[model samples]
Target chain A: MACETDKALLQENIEEYIKDDNKVVTCKWLSLMHSIDINVAKRALHIFVHHQRNKGGNDDINVTFFVAGLGKSKDGDLMHKCAVVPETELEVVKRSLATVTSCHIFSVQKAKLKDYTPLYMTDYEVIKDNIDKCNRFSSIKCPWVSLKSGLSASKSAQQDVVKVVLSENKGHAFSNKTETGNDSPGSKTRALAKKVEPKGSITSMFASASKKDGGGNESSKPVQKTDAASKIKATKKKGGVTAFFEKKGDSPLKQKDVLLGKDSKKMDASSERFESNVTNEKKQDPKRKKKQAADADEEAPDKKRRRRIKTDLFDSSDDEDVEAGEPEEPEEEIEEMEQFEVLDKGIEEEHKMTEEEQKEEVDDSSLTKSAVVGKKRKRTKKVVSKHYEDEEGFMVTKKETVWESETDEEDEASVNKQEKKSHQSNTSEDMGKLATKNTKAKADPKGKAAAKKNSSPQKSKQTSLMSFFKKK
Target chain B: MFEARLVQGSLWKKLLDSIKDLLNEAIFDCSSTGITLQAMDSSHVSLVSISMNSDGFDTYRCDRNLSMGIHLPSLSKIMKCAGNDDIITMKATDDADTVSLVFESPNNEKVSDYEMKLIDLDTEHLGIPETEYSCVVKMPSAEFQRICRDLSQLGDSVVIACTKEGVKFSASGELGTGNIKLCQSASTDKEEESVVVDMNEAVCLTFALRYLNFFAKATPLSTQVQLSMSKDVPLVVEYKISELGFLRFYLAPKIEDNDGDN
Candidate 1:
């Protein structure tokens, strides 16, 4: 049964929805169902009930009761059914209300008589049982039920894990039910085991699902959930609530996860699965390697790519000639590449890390801000990419290097975090140098890459190998 | 001091009525020889020159050269006090700030005086070089005014063409094109109805119809109007002030883009 506040919210939402198009609200149920937009459906539902009562010539009937009658549809023998709402009508209203609220309607609730789980239940019971007051629901101080999260952790987790599976099967809708059924048991157990780490892993899973959906070419099997979770964990640190449900889902468990113990375990399993999947993915499709490399190039700090390209250009000039398809001008290209390399080494330091590891490292560096609360914020665990530090200045310099160009969008938040850390006896000079390096890298890509790669261990290895061959 | 008295005040009234629409104020230079007013319309695309000799006035006197700036609308309003046959006397002391117009009825039944405020106007006086026009047309003033009024409905500008055979006033707009051609009249006894074009070469020029209609307001002042045209020069529409000189209107021809011709 709907609470007084829920009824008021419904009335206000319907009013706002119908205020624009009063004609559409008067539309018949059959035609109303055909409306693709939910606002139209909600408004049409209001008008349907309005007209229904008007047909009975009940001008004297309370508008509140008439509005409450919105949950009752006149279908077949169900006409004039006692004002107690039907489940199907609630489902219809919820569908339309989802559009009105700019969110999905997961569940509708009345004020419960007792205390429940503290995880995901938003307080919707503050409407103060006065339907006839015509009070605006907007003015009423009811904490909104976030549609992204479940009513309770256990209940919403099962639903969202199923949603995660369902979203995974969206591309292949024919096998959706079977795939969802298969994962229902495993995800249920994983959901319980991942209670503390739900936001991080679930959000990461959503990000990977969205990434999968973006790729569209890949036929996703249910087995890829662990891999998806890992990739999401990698990408979702900077991308908060990228997945639809994850935004609301993040709100729950946000307050309750004091224990970091279970979250670290979940991250390890997901990261291991991610690393395994990367190898298999690299092997199955050589084309995908180039794409992943490009994706890495896109995701990698501009400073790092500049460094990598710089090293790739200089140490192995012959290798680049073969790679870039400019055999006719090899001498000139190598000369140009050398000149570019000399200028680049004056600025950026090169480092060698796989693109995936670099992305993980970037995410981890961003997470360094929240590292104090490791257990509670599962999002902080995404900082998995830690480079081997030979010196404090050299290794820690990567965060400033990562601050270069492409990551500037996400870097703003990360910059705030870095600023707080930099205020306490950290190298402020390196921060300024890195800031200038970012601007320079933005100006001259060729110079930035060559300069950036100067610090790469990979470049040193390649150069040493070349010298060995030359000595031979 | 400057004083000029004319027998028929209605003539100045008609001239003022026609030019008042184009010019707000004008400097009337009163010399020992005559009174000459030279001014451009507000847009500077058209110029009006009124030259009246001292011989045309019943009495004329100028103590020294005086250029009096007069608002045309106010002059038109003062002229309204005079009957068609009233004697009009315009008087101003040396460096007078205001000009006085005295009107006396023909039968001495009524007399009225009007004093109008004068303003200092900085006006550029263009020396119009005299040129032998390629075409000169003499047509009935009312007929010319009628043609301008009718054709202005067709477009913003009227293209006047003078050939050996005839003179044509043509206009084209969104509604359609209209052309009124009056061939050289062969000895029409009624001279006012005749079209006489003396042409050395064929001449065609486009002048804004709005100004042409505004120039047509002088229809009440004269029986005939003379139009003179030459290539790349301003077209002149002159109404001769009988026993005086002339009230001539000079309009710059429209520069038609060659792109349209090509």
Candidate 2:
């Protein structure tokens, strides 16, 4: 059985392969068996489609199982039966799952993810009328059939119209208006940064700090640092959202439906923090800083953004805040969660932040209450970066200032992993449903859907295309 | 996309000859560029540097700037399968850490992705001397292999003395003295070649023939055999492999230390 997490990755990869007219895509199906490069598969598919269009007459030739396994035929090509002595159980399972998932994405079925099955071809027009408008046949072959179905037959171009929209918006970072240069899709960055813990040197420093005192230590530092951090964020998050909402209208959020939470308890929580978290992104790290006026401009934005996020925590503090007087203790928990979420997202976005933004996390940690007021320090000043070492004892130094030039597609695996995690969270009904469809293709081979019939000779091309690899 | 399921029962094999010189005992210290790998018969030598494109399985989808730090576990897998004729596909998803390989064995029985690891191959020893040779020669690996095989029968110690023209390999026994001569000529007339001597300097150093035989077993074929020595200085024999570079060994001649034959 494939694990839930891996299944999710398999599903996404499969879906992305078949989602569009992916008739021309290249996908690498990774299972326990040997890897099949899809680019080669596509060329094979092109040849198969070419073969189907070439032989206009349908004689029901029995060929290999691709779409053929489940007693169905694909975009009409030659057919082959399953190999008599099948591959190992694991290979059989993976191949079977791939076929089923591929069929579900290509053929028409119910709009809902659960109702999808590989049984029916989506377009009845092609099936009932026996006419594929988009496909073109240059010739026909079959001894029993009429020789009259000649050269240059064509079919209509029906672009795949059913789009696969993720059920949940898969939340993007909010109030992250600094455009911190620290940018990558949330899902991928999380997997990698999560895997690469900030433990190398800084962790040892933490251990040494605990040990250096001969066992009786200054355990009070982390708590104080946390408190100070919370205080600073409380003061900054306010204007951040106001700026984004007051102007941009966040039209992108509409399509994502991040507001999809069903419960009033959750909605109220989302809405309040949502207002601050969502709307206040407008007040950023001085989007339009004065050219050279150092002290004043530097102080304004940091204080404002932190103040906004911090205030959003207190003002909303979960549904309990609705009572006007929530207990102070529980209130603090909600505040920390919101702050952590906000900060985590900030770190996520700050992926591209110049050396300047990196210094903020480092410097802010070192600040005493009086420092922010007394110094008109330029944010870019190296002195601020130095301050962070004094405070965090150098955890921030271990992290890259920002990833500069990498593209976005590289994170697909990590994003797929994140999708699985969200499914694990079972965040919502729709999100779960959407996630389930993707996960099914990758998870266990046992519950695999039966393969449909389509003579996808694309596989032979895959083997052939892969031939050049050893030499290359 | 098309997919195939392969069962396990596949075989992959490859036979690569060292067209260049190689001293197998020196496989560890060969420089990346100095025939660290060469054809088994002194045909070609290659300087190789294997580097990871990214930290894990990541590779540039196209030619672009990518910086990835590979781990060790993955590299060993690649090295293990270098001789396999299986299909190997290393595809990098967007994540730098994500890399996958599909290894399809020649028998088509199974294909699996073995992970790749990044390692730093540093074999340059700072203080080692780039030894200057006083005497050198070119001989097949088999000839030396055979000579070592035959010389061990006489006694353990085989003395190698060289002049400008050729080398004289002699081993002494209580019953008699055995001497083999290799001259510079192709030996058109003589059934056995003689050791041509001009005597710019005549130096003899004795070494255990058993050690020489063991060294040959460890090496691939050799088209050239080079021996560099000074009276009692260590002798250096190196074999250059085509693409793999050279393998070398340095052995100090045996001396009759204080407790002779005790």
Candidate 3:
């Protein structure tokens, strides 16, 4: 009756059921009774008939076979026919057909069958009773059918209950049936449903089932209820497209914060974390780290010192905040904050580097004004050098040249110097005035001084743009 | 030594274009008979098999069997440089580290040669056994491509159902479900355009549309595409490459979650 067929039990059941002289045993009847394959039942019937004939006393057993074949009709079209014939007439029936596709024992009896009406009626009754279990012993199994025990009776009862409870809700019954079928596999189909059934229906079913039991851990009931509630919430969240858009919309705001330099404290924390992560990565490849360290020492010691000081300040502040908040807050919140801080600092540093490069270009143009002078016209070449760390942590130096012209060289030189002086004065004043208001403003002067020191050696060589174009 | 030449150089270009998107690198096995390539996509969900007979080439010669592992995108880039009417001749010596390709104009006025380094690739050759499919459908390659393209807009996976009556392609997603059914065409006058379904039993399987779209790139190589399918087996999509041989793609079906249940 289960998935596997018991051959010994099947043979015994066939022998016992055919002991009655008036009772006839059909292959379909035996298959439905023992839940064995139809072909296996037919083979068992043949063996039983053969064994009785071999007894050598009174051979009264009669066997009939089911024959199906493709035969031509009068119109020349292929006509498929299936008929039940006695064992003696099987060969004659086979000779009359074009091709015998299948020939299996149809039934076993004591007397030869005059009419097949009783056999059909009895087999129909058996099939009608076991219609739901007809596919139980089939080779191809349906997952929804096999998942439940006492499938036929219980499923009908549950369907009746669903109908009474949710008479107006069509999807409720369908979804409930799928839910009770298989949990995970059916969930995919449920997720694909266009109109999701209300959560109340699912929970109500659970509530009703629990009430029917009437006795369990009362304390555990509310916990299970809350679990179901949260699961409902999760499914609701997963079903919406707005949640995805909301997440995408939040990233640009964070980028804007980094660009505006509004959260320096957060930026410092993040940069510290970024440095730690970089050091961790460098530890994996020490040779690259050593080379980068050597390059850093040769290129910008002052910037390194500034970075160290800022990191130390950030570490001390972070320690104080952790000591203050450790007792009340969880560690996960702190970790999330650290991650956000690191991301903010990386973006902020990139933006700041671009701004510094632009300011350096402006400084180069200003310095070139003091070098070039001519009687009629003057042309000045400005070299712009950019320094950045590559992914391998090596310093990459890129240089570009810009040519400028002025009719009155001396006048332009004086004006450029004054403009540079005013810019420097304004920055220095802003640094001192807004020292407490903005930490970023305080770092500007140091960056400008470093840029000037790096660019001082290139001032002597300046060329006019007109020199290249002159047709001399 | 091994050498082969093709009068229509554009065939190689189209072949490379068809496979370059699916494979990053492939190994070409060349023998006295022909050249064949078998490779799986990066995801390993789909496999591509190509064969060309030596008789199809204008001239062919081989002293020994050779396996050349070449980067496909790079080869495609080089193939793009050849003119449509240029005669392409590929030559390589025994135990050679590089292969040379010469492109000669029809009038013998201009000639260009390019050499590419071969890589030593460790490859495991999979032995594919021939199988009898329950259902085999032959339809216009363009129509198949159109169906795959249109269904991809509705879902990520397409369910192909082949019955005695006809074959149906359907896909369901957040937007809606779309079904396209093709009945056996009654008229066989234009054999290339007729839709034929030869089936012993009905089989329905689901496949990823993204890979089907990739396989459909061979539409220009042949007018007809053959789709062979069976239950619990990979589907084969084949396109005959004119007088050359065929390009076949085998895609594993998307196993439903319930299929794993005992």
Candidate 4:
């Protein structure tokens, strides 16, 4: 092969060429260009031309490949040339470069080019994709220059300084173009739109890319698209390529929706419903505040919205934030119940005297109240709360006749719920009260004393249970 | 009658300091070899066994093999009364219910004696069989203590994996996964300072960090700590007290439920 002849000729002047003069090509420099065995530098020189393939251009331009040497300035163009034998393949060049760089070929990667991203050039795929760039030198500009056993290495070192300044200038200009491109309104709008759209568009883009890369294999297409889309999304969001493979599937929309559905089926249904109840408990006033009555009506619909949020495919981050915010809900209900208990105790003491005198004085003044106990836990709470809203209306009218001057700071909302609860307990307590009242009526004619003992403690248990659920 | 005197009372004080956080009481079995204490914590998740040889003590005397059940907190309270260099003498009758601790200060400057009542505790003595551990890693006690302390803040449990390369302590939780790897250090001037791993085969086990933190109390007693582990068996963390015997801690592994997938 032609490469073999070129490799042998380069090996002859390996030591002289490696001298620190402008021609000294170290393995460190060559490893950046291509993956090569660093050990090869110990044996021979590796010289090859890099054919620059300008995107949208057919002509392949010759670019001097400087492994670790100074470039000679000629006509304002910085070009590095070295004397070497001919017919070397890119592989031989990479092996020779690896020897100088002292880096394994598998670890090398091409620097980020204008068109393509910085890719792992260690594999055959990267080499095959950029085959045009791996061409052998067509002609040596400085053919007469020869590096013998003894030569001054200082000549090459001086030339490298000029090449370094030129490269820095080029890098600055290239970065400026990219900054302007990103700043354009058109580009900004497109990026923003991509964020707004669900993952459906990204999935299609991934499908197309996979189809082009992997050919007609449809079975593995979904998996590959998921990997690619997730990789892109993770990198975009995290601003680092390292986050690409951090998760199994991190596509923002489809995967999250799927996750939400599964989470909803598992725990979302109860947790979401729990959130609404908490929100109601927090906002609801124990006093008969008009706003509290309005909030109760709105709470019925909020529960449906919570259930809807669970069934509908949606993002969970927002849902999680709401859940964390309402942890104080349970504490509020306990506070409201305490205030209502104080009012109920005062009412019991006032009614205690009248009940003792008229043993059958079942005060029918509270009969018009909605104390209808419905079947099941849910309906019972709904019927009781609804009755409280109605009782508040009657409580306003009957306040003067019954417990006068007790209006301010009294939580009628809680009082209404407690009143319904106490009423329910009274009916149960009524059964016990009747039996006891009959014994007291026969034994000592003090039926009111026995009735008070049975009703008071049972009413407290009922109030505690009411606060425990706080069912809106 | 049973009496054992420790020349360095500070060491025994640290031994009690390490366990008082987890266990309230323990039985001290006085045997001819020395004094051995083996007991489990309240949850029965961890077992701590301490044995001191008769040769290790300055003066040791036991007429008969006796077991004295004592509350650890009360004993630790008495231990705190003794100065670092004080001579601690533990005396209890074979059939008596209370134990007296005599603390003789350095140069006999001041001496204080405390008699703490002992309870009759009916605790089953578990005979731990000899386990052929797959991996044994010897490392600096301070390093082990620091790793356990730091990683406990990250998770409730830690996974200890031992291989030919090194021993790794890994914890994964809401924050993320953290791993501390200690490779066998190259032989230096002090061999004890270097981490050494001896493996018959690789073994990986998960244990609760809560117990590990409790066991790390023995860090002050020994310079080096050894971790012996086998698959599905409790991991043993042993700290060998020079001239004395060793303090060994055994903790049950948290088994992964395959069917329940917990």
> Which is the leading candidate under TM-score?
4
A32-126 per-residue lDDT for model 4 (tens digits): 13343334432233232212122345422222132322233233323222222112233355444313332221111122123212222222343
TM-score of each: 0.37, 0.24, 0.39, 0.40
Q: How large a fraction of the reference contact set does each model reproduce?
A: 0.00, 0.00, 0.00, 0.00
Candidate 3 on A1-472: residue-level lDDT in tens? Answer: 5423566566667767767536689887887777777777888888788778888998777788989897754445455666789899999988878999989898987767888877766565665555435434444433533322321222233333444345435555565665554445434443324342232222232333333322111112222332221221222232234334323333443443454353433444444343434332322224323434544433332322323323433443343233231122323223223323233333222222222332232223222312221112233344434343444556555453323332123223332211111121234544343323222222223354444423332121212212222222
TM-score of chain A of 2: 0.17
A1-472: candidate 2 lDDT, tens digit per residue = 4555554454444334344324212211211011333333333434433454476885222212223233222323222222221112324634543243222112211122232122222222222222211111212123442211111000000000001011111212321332235434543343333332333322222323332222212222222222222222222222435433322322322211233323223323332342334333333234212211333333333313433443443433332223222122452244233323333333222223223432333223222211322432221101111011222233221111211111112111222221211112223554444334333322222222212001111111101111111221
Q: Candidate 4 regions off by >4 Å? A: A1-335, A341-472, B259-262
Steric clashes per prediction: 11, 109, 2, 17
What order do candidates take by lDDT, descending? 3, 1, 4, 2
lDDT of 3 by residue, B154-223 (tens): 7777889999889999987656779999999948789999999999999998888889999999898889
Provide a comma-separated list of chain B TM-scores, one per candidate. Answer: 0.97, 0.52, 0.96, 0.97
Q: State the lDDT of candidate 1 residue by residue for A7-47, as single tens digits.
A: 45544544443343331121112122232233443444555
| DockQ of candidate 3 compared with the true complex | 0.01
Give all candidates' CA lDDT scores.
Answer: 0.53, 0.34, 0.61, 0.51
Q: Which has the better TM-score: candidate 1, or candidate 2?
A: 1
